[model samples]
Target: MSIRQLFRMGMVTVALLGALPAAATTQLRVDLSQLSRDSDAVIHGVVRRVESRWSGDGRRIVTDVEVEVKEPLKGQPGGTVLVTQPGGQVGDIGQVVHGLASFKTGEEVVIFLRKRGTQAFRLSGQAQGKYQVVREEAGKPAMAVPEPSEALLLDPVTRQPSTVVEKPRTLAELKAAIRAALTEPAP
Candidate 1:
C-alpha cells in the first residue's frame, strides 16, 4: 500500500478508538444487610433537582443531586440532602462512570447514603445503594427497584462473581428489612 494510504488508515483507526466507550467498571455487590449496616442514612425522597459541574480540581465532573426528604428511615429528621456523585456532563462534554448511581428530577427513590458533611451525603455502594420507587398501577403499592447496573459485580468477601440476586420489593417491605438489618447484632 502507498504510504499516504497507510497514514489515512491509521488516522481512521485512531478516531474510531477515541469514539469507543470505556469499559464497564467493576464493583462489589453488597447485600441489603450490609448496605443497611454500612450506611449512615437511609432516605426515602424525591429528587428535587440535579446539576453537573466540574470538580474542584477541574479534572473531573461531579453531579449534585438535591433530594427532598419524604422520610428518614435511619438517620436524623427529614430535610433536604445534597448527594454528590462522580461522573456527569459539563455543557457539551460528558462522562459516564458505569458503576455509579444516577438520579432524575421528580423521581421517587430510596437511597442508602454515607454522611459526608452537614446535610451532605454520598452513595453508600455505588448503584447498589439507589432504588427507584415504581408502581404498577395507580393506587397500587410501590416497589423499590434497584438500579440496573452495568458494572461487573463481585462478592465483597470472596472477590468472585456475586451470587446475590436483585429483585424489587414493596416499599413497606424494604423499609422493614432495613430496620431489621439495623437492629441485628453485628457479625
Candidate 2:
C-alpha cells in the first residue's frame, strides 16, 4: 500500500484504542456460607492489636480485634481478628484486630464475624468485614446486622437481596420471627 494509506490506518487504530472503555475492577466477594443463622453477621469489636506490618514489608495491615468467635459469643467478640495474608503470600488473610488502644484492656465491644476458613469457624473479619451495631434499651447491648454491602454477598444467586430489618421491630416482633423460622417445618 502507499505510505499515505499506511499512515491513515495507524491513526485510525490509535483513535479506536483511545475510545475503548477503562478496565473494570472486581470487588472482593466474601464467601457467604461463612456466616451462621443470625449471630454470624457482622459486629464491631475493639482493636486488640494492630499488626499492620506482618511477616514482611508491612504492606498488609495485620491487626487483632477482640471478639467471641466460638460458642456463647457467636456474634460478638471476646476473641480477636488475626492476620490472614501477609509477606506477599496472601496468607489467607492480611489483617487482624488484636484489641488495643481506645478500646480498654477489658472493655466490651461489638463485631461482625464468621468462621475462619482455616479454623473451626472461629471469627476472623472482626473489623475486616460487615455488621451494623445498635444499643438496645432493654440493657442488652449488641449488633443486629452487618455493613449494608454485606447484603449483596449473602446469597450469590439472589440478584436482589433484601436488607429490611423490620423498621419497628420489638422484642415480641423478633420472637415472632424466630418462632416462625423454627416452625418452618423441615422445609
Candidate 3:
C-alpha cells in the first residue's frame, strides 16, 4: 500500500477509536423516603481509612471504606463498619464509576447501606445514599449535605430523568425524618 493510503487508514482508525464511548453506569431513582425504607442500615460516621482493591473476580475496582460509626439509626452496628463502593485508585490504575459514592478519610458522613450477603454491603442509591457532614457556619453544629448526583436520577413525580437538588438538613432533622419513615407500615 502507498504511504499516503496507510496514513489515511491510520487516521481513520484513530478517529474511530476516539469516538468509542467509555462504560456508563445508571443509578436508580430513589427519594428520601425510599432511601430510608430500602436501606438495611443507616449510619452516621467519620471515614477513618480508604483502601482500593480489585474485586474478587478481578474484573473491576472496588474501594473499602472503614468508617467509625458515631451512631446507628437503622440497624445495630459496632464502633466501625466497612463500606464497599465501586471504583477506586489502586497503584497507578484507577477506575471511576460515575454516580458511585466516594469517601475520603477523616470526612464525616451519613450513609444508607444495603447488605449484599453474609458480610458485604453497598450504598443504597449510589451517591444519593451518602451525605456529607458539614457545619452551616463556624461554631454551629454540623448538618448532612447530600452529595449531588442529579444527572443520575429519575424524578419520581415526573417519571423522567432529571436533576433534583436537595438542601442540607440538620442531623436531628434527618434522624427525625428517618424515625418517622421507620414508623410507617411497610407496603
Note each model's CA RMSD in angstroms.
Answer: 6.2, 9.2, 6.3
Lowest-scoring 10 consecutive residues by lDDT in candidate 1? 19-28
Candidate that beats the other on lDDT, 1 or 3, i.e. the better one = 1
Q: Tell me the TM-score of each prediction against the true structure.
A: 0.84, 0.35, 0.80
Encode model 3's per-residue lDDT on 13-98: one tens digit a residue.
99998985443555557877778899999999999999999999998999998989999989976788888888898889999888
How does residue 80 of candidate 2 score in lDDT?
49
- How many collisions per candidate? 0, 38, 0
Tens-digit lDDT string for candidate 1 (103-173): 99999999999988776799998899999999789888999999988887888889877768789999999
What's the alpha carbon RMSD for model 3?
6.3
CA lDDT, every model vs. true structure: 0.90, 0.38, 0.83
User: Which TM-score value belongs to model 3?
Assistant: 0.80
Give the top-scoring candidate (lDDT): 1
TM-score of 2: 0.35
